[model samples]
Target: MITTFPIVALFILLGLAIPVGLVMALVGMAGLHSIGGWDMVSGIVQSTPLSTAGSYELLTLPMFLLMAEFVLISGVADDLFRAGAAWTGRVRGGLGMATALAGAGFGAICGTSTAAAATLSATTLPAMIKQGYRPDVAAGVVAISGTLSMLIPPSVALIIYGLIAEVNIGKLLVAGIVPAMIVTFTIIATIYVLVLRDPSVAPAGPAVPWAEKFRLLKVTGPVLLLFAFVTGTIYSGIATPTEASALGALAGFGLALSSGKLNLGTFRKALVRATYGTCMIMLIILGATIFGYYFALTQITQDLIIWVQGLGISPWIVMVMIVAFYLVLGCFMDQTAILILTVPVIVPLVVALGFDPIWFGVVMIVTAEVGLLTPPVGLNCFVVSRYSGIPLSEVFKGVLPHILAHLLALALIVGIPEITLWLPSHMN
Candidate 1:
């Protein structure tokens, strides 16, 4: 039944409150059943789960999630935010800048935007609000800043992209560094304008002594070390990305315990959180795998690609359209689901167009980041709204400027692919 056109059922199920994972899985099984009855379905079920679960690349997802869960459970995010606030708090638009900068640091702890936004909102929003920062600015900065993780090392989005596209995972991880830095700078620049236009929105904070500022880094040192440890091993070719993730998770756990921040209960909680998060991610992957199988059986993605190629449109035009599609999809869906669902179809088309996979990955991730800031279903914006009791309308208003800034940055990345590819090119 599903093989006739599983996609219709997919959306129908999605509309009916079916979980995305289960929906994909069901459509896939149904497609197989349509093809060869229960025999085909059973054969695929036996093969798919093991292949999906046993893949080495998939190992990174759980480890990354575990490391982040431990860090959040340990309350390291708070210390990291405080350290950032102390350093950048004194300048015009200081608190906002600090939020962006601090996000870069804490991005290492959480690779997903929602996790970072929630952690940041709980950690920094109250302080920003108390400091006379406008609620919208405070909430917007927290929400938008959460996107830093998309470009940061160990990014979940980048990992999944690399896995699906069969790109070099280590190189993709290295590739994200410069672009992430670029986005961070763009965000800070945006913050400056937002504050300058209305100082009342985010008045300058008190200046701190140089010694005190340096000391503040100490407060965030453990998490930073964990980041450095993971990235260093990956960049220097000392370990595989998989190895680095495991090491990083262990280091995160050790840091939490040694610092007396992780208790037995919290440790258990982190494990539970990590398990749930890992399961959520794995389920999505399982669904995507099944969906991809059904998609391949149909050859629809190939036909579409061939059709686009026949049109002789500039590959760049096609690329832009592909990104636009992502932006539109991002408005209504989670970034992860958007990326996973589209990758099977879109990536092959991108590869056929002669674009570098790593660069396209960065571009798509940036576009997805913009989606996180867009209206109606913007998860990060919703996170800010829930935390601050600000209406989504106001939160979206505050984030609109930043979304424009991200779009500008995305244009730069798309135009000059070097911005996204330079570091990975030189990677060991």
Candidate 2:
């Protein structure tokens, strides 16, 4: 029944094209009836909102989201990306590479893939396109690079997964560091390769003087400081992730205000957008909780595990299969929705195989991050195309290399557990 519940719900969700949050609720409602009585369903409905909302840690979601909204609204991301581009534009494929690096830096505090996509596309894509970069390359770089927001610290997806899976949010946040860097650098390298092969795709911009580079560095310092505060405070045990997020949000707001960029209008818009985003996220969590409750009562997950173990297949094979499943599912579902829908089942299977919950969380996020660039429903790609006036087809073509780079990073994290584990362990 647990298995059938999700399968049936998947069809129901797609059939009606319902909002993800509602679909999760519907699935949960149906699964509950199959596993338990209406009383159980009632209990879930009553408990889930309070459970999801009561988390002090969740305070970070709105704070950090508001922070990013302010940055985008106030045009701070534009300044940072401009500074970065000015410094990096002299080299082969430099503008495109700068986009990825800037995205990473922005992701350090922003943590929202769509914000990164919209801001970076608005900030960098037009510049690169105007400067003679290939449309697909520009669009693809923005699309895939925006996904850095998911892999970096303070990622909303990671935080949500950690909360639901009962993993330590700090550990999940720490674990994301190496994987994020690996993906970011690999993307830059991919850009270099592409430009090197077809020089026409990226004509190098004129170099900025060292003094000007220093000037650009001055503009970028605040973002760097905010990034350090968010991650450093958490790793140093000086503050919880929630506290760090609050700090980051305040810092982002101050930075924008200090720059004379954020005003009454931007503040209002940021709050409204943050509230809407927070509501969407909370609703999804509530829905997943109900759905997961029903799935648990059915014991289908347990039965499937036993049946799979009966096959005498190694646990590693099962692990690989699950990762493969996420990659495929990513082609359709958004990362947050996928996490809410799958982690209840997947995390348990991963734990059964002796994988660290934190490590698996990182792996899950990275897999889902790839979905941000996957075709058809790839949100980041569409966002970039929208902002850059590039054809979606071109953005799809451009994202191919970055997609391969992400796949490689995913394989490494899967094969070597230490990469994700080292930081969290050392900090402890």
Candidate 3:
């Protein structure tokens, strides 16, 4: 029987003001000592960080971050948003749709929600508002849409979940392709429907000259080429994700140079930010590694799985319960923090119930994405609010409609695991 003391210790420490990584490591150290003695405790603590630091699959994390930083500093996203605006400009709610589409594209490459929200908000919201998109709709769409990155491949969340769950990261990355498309379209449709419901939310924009629309692609060419190459290589089985990320980083650097955004100062800034991002993520991994070992020592997951199995409920019921738990957890915690703390417990239960980890990763992420638009701690909302100069309440109010769309997308994936599994199943 797992004692309440360890679990209590975990919660109590988490509730305190300590950094998340430190809290996990501290509880893990205490748990390790009790279950396996000083030698085992010290041995695991000493070894986990080394193995985590040395991980080969882990190389992709930093490389992807570098790629995003390069793209950000180079203004690649500016062209993307521009093209999206031109193409969708004349349609009702089209600017918002363009923002959503550009958000998906950015998220696919960057995989960081706060950065995406801030960057895309700055890029798109001002124009959307000037174009007569309601202040709420303009900021809300960018804020919520930016979270699409958390769902799409090259995603940090999926990578972490794959690592913790011991699933194939490549397949996990690949699995997100179809579901992302589904979500992207849903987001667009949600925007369109809201505008349809109340035309004041977003007015129809004047048509772009076809010539001008195509002309905008001039600035967008390098980014389009890079995006195609990077995503294509991964989907085509031509490169491991890490290798593709390296290529993408190179492509981003080249684009940065071509765009006139490259400089010693800019390069250094991107590199430093990537380093900081990589270190923070690595710490979380190490902490989770220690915490996973601690949970194993206490048999918490194993015992919980057995007890839940004894209930004789349907597997899908348990899966829904897990999703609900994540939804609740997400409201109060950072997505990364939730991943480190819950994946160990949740993955085992999910596997024991015969669910695919990759599919569950998609579901987990979509649920978490909803949290990013929700209240009390919606980081993305705050990022958008700060950048757009909108109140947080207005931003949240705007995101509510799209949040429904996100929930619909979640239901679609949950109802059809094939949505997430089909692409991965065919991966070369």
Candidate 4:
């Protein structure tokens, strides 16, 4: 069954001519018939959507997406970039560093990699290039920084992983904090070193006066407030993650309106975009639900777990191998597809190895995040490349350092579980 089902599924994926959601759903249906019968497949199809979507947790998806859209449409990315540039631009290679920091900050509110890359590239890349930053560095920083999407609070990938693993979504979110900050700083430091070695690659921006530096903070102040409110509410037990998402979305809209950035066309576009994002996510969820069931019924999940335990290999090695598999898959698949296809098989393996599911959820998010910067199908690189009109090769070249930073962060989390577990521990 493994040979046949996965083979068929691979061929379907390789076709790459259909919506991934439809492919997963069809594959699941085929697997169901092979194992059970048409009756079981029929039942799962009827019930999967309601089972998957009729959850309070899912409200976070659209709400967080909407909040991000509002900020993007309202010109908040520009403000944040300006503030970051004012503070860091004076240092050699500072613009690239500032772009990474700003991308991380924007990522705090927005959870989608493609969105962060698009927004940051549009707002930051042209300015960096104009300031004499090398196209490679300018494009690379934006590509990598967009990966903050999976590390920051309200990350859509983490939310989906939580739902599938039946772990606490709020706890998983809290766990991402340290890893996210570490990655952002690591990327910044890498940029500093790269530019120092090749001085001509980055030139310094004029120093802003202290007064002007402080003045730029006003542009980003409200954004910080929104981030704090959304994440703070969840940590304090004042609301679930989904509820906080709703509040955050409304706050984002209000912020945009008060800033005079909201218009009929912009507002309409944001809604349309949010709806589209929500639909795409839901379709994947539905597909995963069906596909995951096939694995369970076929005993693939159980047999794989037993075989791994019996191998007498260090569980840590198994865990590392699993993460490595994700890295390879991420090179070709989108973040959503990676989660949907692997979480079912991988979750049981981790739990059987005595690792905390919540920690693994955080780890999975961090691992999947590299997809945004990986080659061939890296979404963030594509988004930035499209926006900056830079060649895809340059964007990929730029992302290499950031990808190393991402791997460093992933290695740290794996070697010391405390980094991911600490925040969730304090929450309880």
Candidate 5:
């Protein structure tokens, strides 16, 4: 009955369109007060926010967000898309492939999917449309491609997952590299197949001169070097994830400065945006921590795990059910909110089933990526539609195929845990 109240209240508050952090905090405090009166609630209210905000691991969030903001101001997204188009534009559906490639590259630097989607929509979507690509195809490609940021290194989602699940943030970030690459390729393949089926969807462009292609490629070097430096240092154990994030932020600022795109005003904007993003995530973490305390007090995770074990079903079936739950929940909730609300309950249950938390983190992210493209609250789709002037229906129409691509990638990761675990295991 105690657990039932909080869960029901959570749903009711969420349905009321309340901010996730406040909703969780209110329900949690109320639940705690119910369990142990105002004394417990007072103690929790005093300690939880400070502890959550003060985490060293949490520093990674703002640094990476700052890095991404600076990179956004740097005009790197435009360069990435142009460079990609130059190389791939002559092939059938080449521009769409270029969008995926550019999206992946931008995602390497920009950790947020909405930013990636908006950037691509502004840069690549127009180009694809002007090139006579089908609007739905173009919009779908842009929307789904943005999801790469959710799985790529320096991913904010994965970082938050690591913190909540109590896994190594460095290894968690490293584990995403291969899965991200596979997803990028899968998206590119999906585009190819789409064009193959209907050549009119993405008509090939005139070939780029070899010289011009090489010149365009040169512009991508710095971005690539920055990504390599950040991920490499972490993989080589030369820097902790937090150290790498600071270094990456420094590099991003340098790039923005060198490009002459970041002025005093832009610099201020970056800091403010980073600060705002950090505060938002911190609040979510704080509320989640409070709620997590209430949840732990209820002893529900242990009971749920025991009940599942006694069900006499295959663990894989249970895993599928969990994934389905995420997929459905994702349709209506923000990805970060989903992670904050569920990781505490799910991670322990997963570990009890003998699943790797690291691998499961990757799977969780991939599912979240899918959610970002699904309807009703497909954030990336809405971003694409808002930026590109595509109808909401068309944006959703376009993402259907890429959603399948995401599923295919998810299946591969789920079936072969090694795909996610291999690189992290070998990390120095």
Candidate 6:
């Protein structure tokens, strides 16, 4: 009853339209009071926020967010899309493929999925639609492509998962590289197949001259260098993740300035936006910590682990069930809320079952990527739809095919753990 009450209340509060962080804190305090009175609640309420927000690792969040905001204001997404289209535009559904390619590149620097989706929708959707691409097909491709932001390095989602799961943040970031590449290509392939089956959905464009293609490629150099600088320092052990994020933010500022985009007004705007984003994430972390304390007091995770062990079931079966649970959960919850709420409970059970936490983190993230596209609360889909002024139904229709690509990517990562681990293992 103790365990069930908090979980049940959480859903009810969320369904009632309460903010996620407040709901978590309320349920947690109520549950703690039920178990250990106000003294326990008092002590936790005072400490959890400080401890959760005080970590040096937490600094990485704002820095990376600021970096993304600066990059967004710099107009790099347009450059990336133009370069991508120059190379891929001649092929059937080439513009769609180009959006995916550009999305992955932007994701490497941007990190947050919604921002990436909004930026791409604003920059690429009009171009695709202008080029005679089907609106639904173009919108769908933009929404799913934005999900790559959360899978690539500097990912805000991965950083939060690492902090909560007690895994190495650096390793978690590096681990995403290969799986992200696989998913990127999978999305591109899906676009090609869809265009092939129904050519009207995406018409091919005039081929670019080899000289113009090479010229356009130069626009990609600054983004590539920024990615290389950020990831290279982290992988080479030359800087901590926090240090890398700070440097990346500085590089982004420089990029914006060089492009004549940065001014006092734009700089202040980025700071304010990054500050707002950081505070929201920190509040969620604070609430999750308080809730985690109450959850730990209930001893549910330990009991669940023991119970599962005694079931005599194959571990893979258990793994599939957990993944399925996330898929359902993703349909309703935001990705950050899902991670902060569940990782505390799920990581221990996963470790007890002999799975690698790093591998599971990647799988969990890929699953979250799927959630970003699924209906009801598909955050990325909503962002794309709002930014592109497309109807929500068309955006949903567009993502149906890419959802299959996400599932295929998820299956490969789950079945072949090396796809996620090998690069991290090789990192210096």
- CA lDDT for candidate 2: 0.84
Pairs of colliding residues, candidate 1: none
Provide the RMSD of all predictions against the true structure, rounded to 1 decimal: 1.6, 1.6, 1.5, 1.5, 0.8, 0.9
What root-mean-square deviation over C-alphas does model 1 reach? Answer: 1.6
TM-scores across all candidates? 0.96, 0.96, 0.97, 0.97, 0.99, 0.99
Residue 87 Cα positional deviation in candidate 1, in Å, after optimal superposition: 2.4
Candidate 4 is scored at a TM of: 0.97
Q: Could you give candidate 1's per-residue lDDT for residues 82-124 as a string of tens digits?
A: 7888888888778788888878888876787888898888888
Total colliding residue pairs, candidate 3? 0
State the C-alpha lDDT per candidate: 0.84, 0.84, 0.85, 0.85, 0.93, 0.93
Sliding window of 10 residues with minimal summed lDDT for model 1 = 1-10
- Model 4: which residue pairs collide? none
Clashing residue pairs for model 6? none
lDDT of 6 at 9: 92
Error of 1 at 311 (Å): 0.4
Which of 2 and 5 is ahead in TM-score?
Answer: 5
* Candidate 6 lDDT over residue span 1-428, tens digit each: 87888899999998898878888899999999999999999999988887888899999999999999999989999999999999999998999999999999999999999999999999889989988988999999999999999999999999999999989898899999999999999999999899889999998889999999999999998898889768888988888899999999999998899999899999999999999999998888888888999989999899999999999999999999999999999999888889988999999999999999999999999999999999899999999989999999999999999998789889989999988999889877
Evaluation by lDDT, superior candidate among 1 and 2: 1
When 1 and 4 are scored with TM-score, the better candidate is: 4
Worst 10 residues of 3 by lDDT: 1-10
User: To one decimal, what is the Cα RMSD in angstroms of model 2 from the true structure?
Assistant: 1.6
Minimal lDDT window, size 10, model 6: 224-233
